[model samples]
Target: MSSFFAAIFLLGLCLANAIDFTTVYEWNKFDFVRPSGVDTSNGQIGQHFHQDQVYFQYMAVFGERLFLSLDSYSGIPATLVWLPTSGSSTVPPKLAPFPSWNLHMKDNCDTIQAAKGMEIDTDGRLWVLDQGSSKCSSKLWIFDLLNNDTTELVHQFPDSVVSHRYFKRELRDMVLDKTPEDYLAYITDSFSDKIVVYSRKMDKSWTVTTPGRKWNSLALSPDGEATQLYLARYFSNELYSVSVSELKNEGGRAAVKLVGEWFNIPCRMLIDSANVLYAAFKYQSYLSKWKNISEPFRDQRFYEVERLDAEQPFTFALDTNGTLWLTERNATGSEKRHKIIKAAVGARSYLFKPSTAMTAPQAYVSGGETSDDMKITQTPTVIVISLLVCCLFLCGSCQCVVNLVRMRRKQTSLRQISKDNREQRSALVPVNL
Candidate 1:
């Protein structure tokens, strides 16, 4: 019996290895398709090009487009770019500037200066942080990926929030505190050690300072107003947390509590809709996850490679398609190549989950769900239930009562299914961590 069980476990591992990380793209070096095949080789067009200088800082997948945020300066041409994910050819596709090439032009106050960090929300919107450089002002750019790549909103950062020394400053990471009532963005500035909070409704941003410098990563819980913001710093073993409500105070004064200590310093972190916290360690090849703050931390070896140093996942993002996409940087030598790998993680990002609790009738029927907004409240649900009860009580004939109950149940099921249709379509099968 024990031998049979061992064989079954081995078979499971074999199956996982087969389906996980079916190499989406393996690029030797990044390239962009120039319009009309124009070669800007000899410092042409005033934007000097070097394929080696540009590197991907962040990536987010929405629908058919895979967006990449690159580290840009005077040497790099575009800070924000994208590549099409749907293609049959095995050749690596070239990166194209997102929105347009004009938006990436240098020194333009309206153009993206340094898109170092980015996040794609559940609403299919791309939120990017343009870390200002060389006199170009810092700004946040949001583009609607679902609606023909429309310009959604642009909120330029003030010197007071990001810093007047924009050239030296860097926005390390970005995360969203998306609730039903409000949409907020929390961005980390490494040079000043502050988290800049931006609000969509007010079109205003505020700054919050913490104890650590070189604040590298930030993760937000999906607990609505009760959400907890996780913080990690470069070369720091201790992790910290602060409530989102505290950070939103008018005075911008909040007490950041130490969550716990880590065995390895986490360089990047992600929290999914399932409340699972996943992290990529600085010097480790494998990613780790924590069920909760108190649960035992486990290292997940989803991707295996011969050289542990070659394939350390630097950044991670979960899409609505139930796939987890991440970028691995092998900055060892001249020949080392960066890779974009993915696995079926069966989870969604924190942005897609319900931030606030809805006190409505949860799926009493098997696959029942709420409306699109999940706006089902307690009072309305109660009133609806009461009306149904009265209808049954008033109906005298058995046939009439049966018919009405069936009709009402069917209607409720349809309403619930449509309610949850937009957000909860990902595969729910749990993979071994």
Candidate 2:
């Protein structure tokens, strides 16, 4: 009987190991690496030589150095950091071969503001997603690195879109949907939980709108064949995907498809050449239940790695090592500490156990993959095979239990013998200290 329990326990652990797990490496406070040089102004490790400002925001690894859109929320000058990578956890105490430049978005702007997302276009032009508001900047600044000018405003969106009340307003982050030609860009309006697609050339005109939220982010594939957008909707703790097809339509509307939820509160999403999607979120929810701030970080915080398991997940550039890169909105430390999260595997679990709270059958459904087909395919034969495996697990568990029981009995008997011997010895001995 005990042996059966032991066998089952062993089998359960083995089965759990069958699934591949992902490891997440995090550098909370630029702990990974540091840039060298002292700005005579503030004397901080990495400061804009021209001025002292806090350079913090989303990062993009281009060459050996990581480029950050220096987002100083308090009207501090916005700049870009080109820090060298030392191949170590801690960054080398030096700047990149070239000095970190404060590519201040000047002209047509009254004050300085923080930038959100960024991208390098097909022609190698730098596209910066500036917050379209007095809150930030009311335009998406495209710096033509080749021309060496920041005064040019490649595209500008109205401030009203970035504000509340519009369908697909601009919050901060922007992505290029450079597919099928003339499809243009997909920008995330975090305030409205919507993604606004715009034309690349001719003033960056608006194209289409999709779902998204504050902490949401996106990326484009290197193949230039598709676009993979990641939305981290905090209210419902849902992660969503919007696709930009390489295929075209007659009306010039890129046949856009909402691929459904990808993960919970996904702060950022990246896709590699192998089609692996790496998602970074504020919190990781394992179930349908909502989570709060007090949740354990080990259980719910940090980023996760997931494979693009569907026919068409999001798209992105594939590096030499086959890694994907993504762009995201401003990830402030406060949000990282307090924001909520959702689960990537929530859809499948919901299908097995229909939630009474769910109003429709479609609630358990996912994008691209339908639950009905999965349900029908899971027949009696599959269940029988599962049962057989479970039985083997039980056998292993029972063996462990039996060993435990025998060991316990042996311990008890030995203690009893020792007690009897002590009693006899005490009777023969005189009282002593």
Q: Which candidate is the best by TM-score?
A: 1
Please give the CA lDDT of all the candidate structures. 0.69, 0.41
Residue-wise C-alpha lDDT for candidate 1, range 41-132, written one tens digit per residue: 43323435676556676878887778888767456777788876545566777888788766766677777778877888767789998887
Q: Please, what is the TM-score per model?
A: 0.72, 0.48
**CA error at residue 413 for candidate 1, angstroms:** 71
The RMSD of every model to the true structure, in order and in angstroms, is: 20.3, 16.0
Candidate 1 C-alpha RMSD relative to the actual structure: 20.3
**Which residue ranges in model 2 land beyond 4 Å of their true spot?**
1-56, 87-102, 105-112, 132-136, 144-153, 159-170, 180-183, 207-215, 219-230, 243-264, 283-320, 323-433
Minimum summed lDDT over a 10-residue window in model 2 is located at 337-346
Top candidate on lDDT is 1
How many pairs of residues collide in each model?
5, 34
